[model samples]
Target: MSMNDSWYRASVGDVTQRDALQGDITTDVCIVGAGFTGLSAALELAEAGVRVTVLEAEQVGWGCSGRNGGQINPGLGCDHGRVVAELGADDARKVWQLTLDGVELLRSRVKRHNIDCDLKAGILLVANKARHVPELQSWQHELEALGYDQLAFYDRDALQSLLKADYQAGVMDWGGGDLHPLKYALGLASAAEAAGAQILERSAVLGYEEDGRTVTIRTAAGQVHAQHLLLAGNAYLGKLLPWYRKGFMPIGSYVGATRPLGELATQLIPSRAAVCDMNTLIDYYRLSADNRLLFGGRASARDAQPNALRATMRERMALVFPALAEEDFEYLWGGQVAMTMSKAPVFGRLGRRTLFAQGYSGQGVALAGMAGKLMAQTVQGDAAGFDLMARAKHWPVPPGAPLQTAIRALALLWYRLQDSR
Candidate 1:
């Protein structure tokens, strides 16, 4: 992967060109951060007749929400069985249904609002190690038990027809797909604004003070006084919520997009299905609507933006398909996602009248919408759904602070070692 400025800018076509912030505002809800989560919640709330104001530190989709791998995967980073094992089968079913609704909701929004972000269908979960076969089989059986026929197993022979060499097996899901995430975000923001929601760009929240009834959010341009507040900042929220910091440890993940491969790109991944190779620290990639290979992986907690990530990601992609070792790489952009220790996304109330959701790990494209939707539900006096997820306890990194990085570094080393053998 090459580190060029113009590398793989999503031919996302165009967006509504919404205006920036210029004055103070007051609304029923003040959402801090305009990524998928914030825009999503704003859309739902506004559509429900709730006045909402969204404040983005930068332009919409400028954060991880836009620059992610762009694979619209279903479910949490951890599987449904993990959810049941930790929670219960009943609650897990509700969670699974929401995950399915996430992708469906995205599709409906794209079609209903005419968001042309190159929406494509299908996502393949590939396994490189022989050890991954049983996991895929188990996942297939689990999904089947839940009456979900969306998943199909692929043996090495079947996988050969779709994926390039150096892979063992895979699980293909028909419902979930890939798209230009930035465009989807832009479309959602546009839709939210069109529905009478206030969206302000380049307006960072300086501070917030919450009383028992309402919260006051202070920003650079002005402030937002609202009955409730939603913090959708995710990995960007370093110490905004100190109590939940341990619940979500920000992990830096990098992605690389290749120059258009034309017919060859289509042939390499014949189905054009978004692919994620199974590993504790996995590698996920998909074809940009323009046919560029958008590959992503690796984990780092520190270093907001590493100087050079292209070569690092290139090596990872080359390991799976050496044929692309000589291809002209295009992009080396990376983003951060707040990963929970349990690998399940955390959503619930923080302080009274305040709602928060983060830590989708790498599965935010769909889950973030679900999180935002959940926020709407919570505000409406519906606590059943949110309570199930918020109950999952997140173990804090042992001594906290400086030791967290050292702990994650050790954990990454161990996981990579496990992946090697």
Candidate 2:
């Protein structure tokens, strides 16, 4: 299937297209990118009666926000234990609460806006190997100590009732779930507009110049002068700001959707919970509301989509459920996601008036929106939440593109070796 043939795009109905930037515009806060982060921030700031303008290179939800696995996994990108070790008990508890709040915020927005995205409950983190079972147990204990009580452990036999895979064990998180990502993103944009935010599509930001008082953002056809700016471009930020590029590596991940499986879908996953294995290169899959299996994983450092993506996805799916070997895939797509070395999001400031958030690793579905909300709070004179998130350390990737690519390749190779054992 072509890149444009993603199941999300095929199913997204009646999206309102906004005009591109023309002439100059001014707002209290200017945002770059209209994905989850930008739209979420726009919604928050506009509801607060702040003037906000969002600029997007393409349509809203055109990036990873629309194309991701759609699994709303809880917590930060890394385990909670790592968070506690790095940020102390008190701050870690705050961070943990914020992550849960992110999930709740998503739920509330979907309900408040009457978004038709098929929101569902339950997510299972499964152990791909026997060694991973103990690690999952430790993870569960760590979260329970942090006051999260929504988790339940399942051994191999117990897992068979929900999933017909070879996973050694699993941890079911009742708090996390899945949704129609493109529809969710579009709903955020609509809500932001209703709250008085202006969103301009097809307006790629060329660059920006920041004076001590105001920041001027320039696109091909227009410029936006604002008191503050929020960079929400994530992996798609490209070379717009070379300095930020070093803090995270953009990796391409692929996903495929089979033709509606009808009754077999429920048999594959009886509980309908999204499942992700404990491998470094994880396989995440869940059933679509219409019954198709949306399977994703297989990370690549290359800029282009991997060759024979459908065959590769089918092979991976068959490994977990042999019955799917003959299934016909109707859609295939891939997109880049920013990943930090520490697996925690990278959030910080560019100046007194400029703030940026990105590198959610594999957990951008919910955390990116929360990052935007916190940035909006910071813009409105409440910086405590943003400051706490900025405390998480993000190690820079090697400076040059070639060096970073080499490092990513070596890392993927190491992960493959580890997963094999």
Candidate 3:
């Protein structure tokens, strides 16, 4: 397989490439990064009759938005109880509501825009080990106490009915689902463009200068001066925002798509729901519309060694379904997800006029889009939700990239060590 031959790209068919920014431009809002967050923000801003300009370093959805597990899983990367402990009751509830809004926002946008991304409803959190089942039970109790009844617990037998896997038990979340990520992203982009937003592909932001009044963003061939700016770049943000870089760690996750499994697909996951394990290093997967199994999981914090990634992912898949051992995976890809120290998203102002939302950890599919919506609202003079997010604290990473990488490596090693014993 080629380096970037992802299943999402292959399944989405041909995509029209947008031209890079070639000259100076001015807009009401300028957004850097054309992934889900950026495009979604542009959509909201454009719908409100605001002149929005979106600049992408690569094509739209070229980042983790295009390369995720496609699971519209709910909640923060951490447990709700942990959130309550850290943020206190009222703030935790508010933040939790934001995530729920994120899920609804995604569903409504897809419905209103008629996005054909093969969206299906249902997600199961399976336990790979018996000890994890009790943790899931605690999670269930916490959610139930919080009046969230969308989740239903399953014993090993009941779970087997939904998934023919070697899992101990599972919890089914009706609120979560899966979709064609790249297609959904492109659909958002199209909707934003139709609503009067200018989207420029391959137009990377070199730097920016923000005054209290207007912010000027410099690109290679052009510049954008806007009343407000958004940094929705997430893991790919790089050194663009030096101060913001330390707030999160860029961790790589890999995915592989198997050839169409025909009737076997239905049998593997009878409910056809997206599924993931409740582990620090999670294994998530869902069936494609054409019956391919899009399996994905965590890799190292660096660019993946394709052959090694494929082997490890395939081995993990086989553990869940021994029958797939002989199956051939046709596509393989990976992308980085930003993980904040607290495992919660970071949403705040760069200065006063520039707002940024990122560090969704691994659950960005729904939340990142919602974060975008919140950013749009802030630009429109409504900062209720955005302010709530900004209150969540974020810690800086170690200074240098090498030091950061070493820290992440040690963290992953510690997690893996715990998982082993």
The Cα local distance difference test for each model comes to 0.80, 0.90, 0.88
Report the Cα lDDT for residue 287, model 3: 94
What would the per-residue lDDT of candidate 2 be over residues 103-192, giving only the tens digit for each residue?
999999999999999999999999999899999999999888877889999999999998988899999999999999999999999999
Cα lDDT for residue 84, candidate 2: 82
lDDT of 1: 0.80
Candidate 3 off by > 4 Å: 1-3
Candidate 2 wrongly placed segments (more than 4 Å): 1-3, 244-246
Local error of candidate 3 at residue 119 (angstroms): 0.7
Winner on lDDT (1 vs 2): 2
lDDT of 3 by residue, 44-71 (tens): 9999999999999999999988888888
Ranking by TM-score: 2, 3, 1
Provide the lDDT at 193 for model 2.
97
**TM-score of each model, in listed order:** 0.94, 0.98, 0.97
Instruction: For model 3, name the residue pairs that clash.
Output: 246-397
State candidate 1's TM-score: 0.94
